[model samples]
Target chain A: MDRLLNIDRRIIFIFVLLGVAIPLLIDIHLPIKPTPTVRAVYDEIERVSIEDPDRPVLVSFSYGASTMPEMEPMTRSILHHLFSRGRKVVGICLWPEAVGLAQPIMDELAAEFGMKYGTDYAFLGYKPGAQAVVLNLGQSMAGTFPFDTAGTPVGDLPILAKVQNLKDFSFVFDFAAGDSMEFWWIPYGQEKHRFPFAGGCTAVMAPDLYPFLQSRQLVGLLGGLAGAAEYEALIGVSGSATSGMEPQSVTHVIIILFILLGNTVYFTTRRRGGKA
Target chain B: MTRDSYVFVGFLALFALVNTILVANGALSLDWDGLGVIVAAGCTLALYSFLYKDNPLFKFAEHVYVGVAAAYVFGITWYNSLYGEIIVSYFDIGEKGANGGGHNPWVLLFPTLLGLLMLTRFSRKFSWLSRISFAFVVGVGAGLTIPRYLSSFLLGQLEPSLAPLTLSWAGLNLFLVLVGVITVLIYFFFSVEHTGVVGHASRLGIWFLMVSFGASFGYTIMARLSLLIGRISFLMDDWLHLM
Candidate 1:
């Protein structure tokens, strides 16, 4: 029992690697249903599509590659819906590394939907300050991001011609890893820009954002891969989120089992010694 | 002066001064760009402020940053929520015009009352009054999250296991999901006694968790690696092309 407790962590690491790898190599995909949280996000998009296809939606990629596995699917699916519906999009990044992370996904989707760079969608690249940038954007989009990711001026982009501030957008969606919540929700979300908003956050951070969601501060939320999978299911597209569900499910169950086992052994051994 | 301390302080002063100038000027020229360079330099110098131990300059800068953030938040909330949504939507005083009939003056009461309740925290005698506001916030938050939590965590999680069980490729996926689910559940079964059957099941669960964790870790590593790769790609593809 002691030996099991003190086993080298490397052995555990190897076991974890196999658990995740086997699923990946086998390309296991499982059926997923859209949860209400995910459905809310989907429904919001649908509402936007039906209400106003011309209204530009602002998307802030506030996370970098480290969070891509969980966030990318949501981002991609949202983009697909927006583009397919002929809604304009304006992409911005708070994280320095997010600019690059968004490039391929945006380009691929843009190409698929025949979206003209400046006309249908634009990437604003990364700004140095986060909250300040959001505030500035709320006040004036051109001031915060004078140039698009391609170095084209916002003034030059026909799609952005009507967009002077964050209020011009019909909705805002934030895919965030950290600190962006206060920046987006408290400052821009609560005060300066009153656009409908949604968020996709890492699992560790999801619980904290629930209050905001409940208050109707956020119209919807994508909590993690689970949230992402649900979003994918809602959109009727099975992408990375769908593929990730198998491994995520497997791992979650495994963790639960181990926790049970560890507690059981400790309690049982102590009981034999009459410690209980 | 210590080498690192001197460098850091110098950079911090430089960056702050430059950025201040650039923001004021609203344009970047070769000469003006030096302001940004200086600000960057000052920030770089300030990086070593931690090494010299806590001091007034570091503390001041840190506090300034916090103050700026607070001010920014206040500004945003005033403009976006209080002004835009409440003032503009209800009162129709701002540029957007009234959303509804503008007759719901009573709607203003809810937010005002809630805000006032929050102010009670400052008074020791009335601190208990703050609970009302806190309760409202928490209650609304709870209400919102309960449904979301169920959808995001429970239904979303369980939905993937509904795959058809067959003897061929479809069955394989079902088998994986079943095994994964059972083992992972075992891993998390903290309340159980791990003696005979339970122990074996728990061990298998541990294996499953480790693998999942490992895969997650590997994915994280890959994601980070991609960032580095992206930076290199930029330097090569974008910057060097100009050179």
Candidate 2:
């Protein structure tokens, strides 16, 4: 019993690695149904595009590379939707690491849509303070982002020419891990900026944001890999999230089996002792 | 004072001084409107005060942050409501009213009342009065979330678990989902005694939970590592062109 209780953590680590890696290698693209949360995010993006194709949508890449696996699919799908509808986009990174991470994705997607970088979209790069940046955006975007990510003056960009504040954007989608939620939602979403908001957050952090979602502070939420898969399904793109579902499914099953086996061993040993 | 405390304070002072100088010299520029580098430097120093000890400096900075946040929020609310809702929606500014209304000024009453009710939290005698506001907020929140949660969490989770049992690879997925659900459930079966069949199941569930937790932890590590890798990549590829 003690042996079972104190099994080497390395053994468990190996089991997990195989469990996640094997399914990933298999590349199983499981069909996913869009949950209401995922659908809500999709519907919001669609609505914004349909309602005002000319107005730019602000997307805050508030997560760093660490949360990319969970957040990237939603970000890609949302951007795909926005660009498909011919809406301009302004991407900002609150996390220092996010500016670099966002550049490739934006460039790739913009290329797909044949969209000009400055005219159709722009990356505002990273800012130091989160809440302050959000508040400044609400007040004056030009003042907050004087230049684009590449250091081009904001005035030179046609897409940002008329965008004076948060009100200029049709809606805001915050693809974040957790740091900027209180900053973006409480101060900006709930208080200053009345723009409809949606969020993409890691699963661990999803439940905490439910209150904000419930209060209508957020229009939709994409929670973790499951949410990401659903978003991919909605966009008709089988991306990393869709592929990841197989591993997620396998690992979840493996954990359950181990639990059952451990319990079985415990009961059988106890029963033998009773018979003795 | 401890030697470590003094060292920390000295380092923080140096950092603050450098930050202030950089901002003043336009080395670190921002896109927004504010007291420029002075406020940034002060806030940075204030936040860093925690490293030395939880003292008056940290408290002052924390309070200032709250105050500035509140002020910014007030400015935004003024702009949104006064401009977006009032001018655009009620007064039909720029012919952009969604509902085409110029005289439905009564719509502002609900928000006004709710805002007023929230202020009651400041008073002891009428603290209970805040429940009215709370009730309204909670009621609406519940109405919005319950239905969405049902579809998003319950139905969405169950749908994937209902896959058909087969002998092929697809069957493996179904098997995994079934076992995962059952075992994960057992892990959470805390109220029941760990005896007989229940004990067996519970033991299995614990392993499942541990492994799942381990996998999650591993992935979290990967994510963090990715952040580090990304920063390095930037420093190389974008900054110095070494990559």
Candidate 3:
């Protein structure tokens, strides 16, 4: 018991490493059920695809490489669903670092679906100013981003020919690692235009946006890799998020066990009249 | 050379040998994409070295990351914002004629001046000039944000809680929300003494706050673990091809 209480933190780190690594080496194929929030997002996107197929969907990649693990999967899963349903996608990035990240993923998925650029999709890339950019986009997307990431004129893109502004989009989803979703998009773009909006964010940032979810300011939210896994399951595609679930679940269980052990030790020590 | 330098040299030699073997074994190609993967994996491992102990490899990787991030930001800012919005828009640098697309060339002067004024903060004597820029920014920001915030965050969130009550599960959830909101508000109300009902409500508020915090903390753990899972997946699938 004393040894357990005084175990080296490095040993615990090893446990966590093994927890993640071993599961990746051996697939667990854990079942993932879509949460209500994530389901809402899926349903909304489905509705948009069915009812307003002509209107382009706005997909904002508001995260960078650091958060790619959690966010990229969600973006991929969403894009898969959209492209498979023959929906047009317009990608934008609020974060400058995210500019490079969006194009590759969008291009790869577009290729998989045999979707042509400028017709099936367009990427506007990043522009400075968070709130100002959102407001400008509300007014005019082509004006804000005159040229797409590839230096092609937005006017030439067949997908965006009829799109004038934010209101033109049938659905908008922001996969954010930062405050761009709640801080900029919700207040500036969604509230004013009253378009259907959903969000995907780092799990840590998820709790902060629950109020927005409750208010229906956001239609649905995908929080972290778990949310991504749920989205992938709903789409019936076993992407990286699905593969990552095993490792993630194993690591979480290890962490919970450690937490329980630590608390039990501390309480027992306190009851024994010893310093915890 | 120092001991750490010797270790680094040894590590580099070992890495080269491993790479050669990988190439010879047809595990990796001598292409740009393959080279990129190797470099990325190297950097990831070097950064993760810190978990064992802070070493020169970790520092080197950390410094490289910071430098790359700073350079990327600088380059993006120059090309995207400063160059595109200012120079291109004003001087008609691109294919679009005077004033580029549709922006009023004269209307941009005020913002350009404000931006230039912001640079005055670098000068000790001229620092006061930056205040004009700051003042305008603050004024404009406040005017734009306050009403939007009131309408969206405050009223929008408040409306759901004030929805008509019923005897269903959703109504029970709404009731809990109402209780949570009122009690939490009472907890922060310092004007009233915690005598009887207020004390109980305040105590309940503390519970609600703790539960919320606990959920947040749990999500935080999940988030961190997900990142670890991601890194491990990269190493296995991309680098080692073990998956």
Candidate 4:
């Protein structure tokens, strides 16, 4: 009981390592059910595809590389959905590191879908002043980002020809790893313009967003990796997030078992009036 | 400098040599992308080396990561914000009249002066000059944010919670949400003593808060596990090509 109570931290680390690494090596196809929150994002995108096909959609990368593990899967799944639906996407980076990290994923998906840069998509890249940029975009996207990442004027881009301001977009989605969704997109952009807005955030930031969702400020939200996996399942094209869920589930079970074991050991030791 | 330092240097040299030989033998492609994967895998392993014990490799990777991040931010700020937005647009440096000539250069002067004034914080005597810029920023930020917060966050939330309750599944869910909101607010309302009905309500509020925190904590664990799965997947698929 004492040995179980005071297990070496490194031994627990090894168990966790095996828990995560082993399932990844083996092929374990876990079922991913789309939650209503995630389904709302998908349904909104579909509605935009049917209702406002010509207008471009704004996808903001409000995350950096550290969050690439969680954020990238959401970005990839959303981009895949947008491109597969023949929706024109306008990519912008609210975070500096997103210019390097997130833009490649967009470009890769664009290539996969055989979409052209100037017409099917345009990446505006990063500019400082996140909330100010959101407000500026509400006014004039062309003025805030006069030129796309490739130095082509927004005027030259066919996809962005009608997209002079935030209201021009059919739908807006922000994959945020920070408070960008809550602080910038919600009040500065979404509320001011009254656009159909959704967000994807890291799991740590997920609970805080439920209030906004409840208020209908957010049309939908993809919260963390499970959310990404659910979106992938909905699209019928499983990607990294889907593949990642198996290991994630396996490790979670291990953690739960450890918690149970720890509690049992603690109670057993304390029943005899011993220090835990 | 020390035995462990020599051992570390030796390991790095061996790693480099192996990679070079792999490239020479066409096992690793002679391209930037391929080399980048190797470097990324190296960095990932170096950082993960900390799990065993604190080591020089982890510290080396940590320093390199910080340095690279700082440099990247500096480069992006200069190129994206300073050069593109300010220098090119305000001064019309690039394709003369590229910005469509509608923006007035003089319009930027006041903000530019305030931005420059913020630099005076480095000086001891003139540090007070920065206060004017700070005050303007805070005043404008508060003025812009206050009304938006009230209307969108506070009122928007309140209106939904107050929706007329009825005998439907959605109404039941809304009722629970309304109750949760009230009790949670009551939990934070500290002026009233928790002696009577308020005590039970506050206790129920604690349960609601705990459930929310437990959900948040579960999500936090899932987020961390996802990161671990990501690195492991990268090693398995990208580095080893086993998947």
> Comparing chain B with the reference, what is the TM-score for each candidate?
0.68, 0.64, 0.91, 0.88
Candidate 2 Cα deviation (angstroms), residue B72: 30
Candidate 4, residues A139-217, lDDT tens digits: the string is: 9987788777766667778998777799999999999999999989988988889999999999999998998987899
Query: What would you estimate as the lDDT of candidate 3?
Result: 0.88
Q: Give one digit per residue, the lDDT tens place, for model 1 in B36-136.
A: 44443443334325445566566766676668656755654454345534554465553343432222446568867888889999999999989999998
Cα lDDT tens digits, model 2, A184-217, are 4455443555788888877766655654564466
Q: Highest DockQ, which number?
A: 3
Give one digit per residue, the lDDT tens place, for model 3 in A1-276.
Answer: 577788888999999999999988886787899999999999998999889989999998888888888998998899999999999999988898888787898999999999999999988778888888999999998778877765566877899889899999999999899998899999999989999999899998999999988888899999999999999999998988898889888888898899999999989988898886
Model 3 Cα shift for residue B183 (angstroms): 1.0
What are the per-model C-alpha RMSD values against the true structure?
13.8, 13.1, 2.0, 2.3
Model 3 misplaced stretches (Cα beyond 4 Å): A1-3, B1-14, B97-102
Q: Give the per-residue lDDT of model 4 (tens digit) for B98-135.
A: 46422456777798899989999999999999999999
**Stronger candidate by lDDT (3 vs 4):** 3
- Identify the candidate with maximal lDDT: 3
lDDT of model 2, residue B78: 43
The candidates' DockQ values read 0.02, 0.03, 0.66, 0.61
lDDT of 1 by residue, A1-276 (tens): 766666676665455444554554465667788777778888898898888777798888888655666667778888888888888888988876676678679889989999989888898777655665676687778756655655455777888888888788988888888757644444444443667888887665665565456445677888776777787787788876676666565555555676687788778778788332
Model 1 iRMS: 13.4
lDDT of 3 by residue, B1-243 (tens): 987778778877887887787778877788998898789889998998788678988999999999999999988777666775567668776665233353567877999999999999999999999999999989989999998999998889889989999999999999999999999999999999987999999999989999999999999998888888888888777877778
Summing lDDT over every window of 10 consecutive residues in candidate 3 chain A, give the lowest-scoring window. Answer: A146-155
Docking class of 2: incorrect
lDDT: worst 10-residue window of model 3 chain B: B94-103
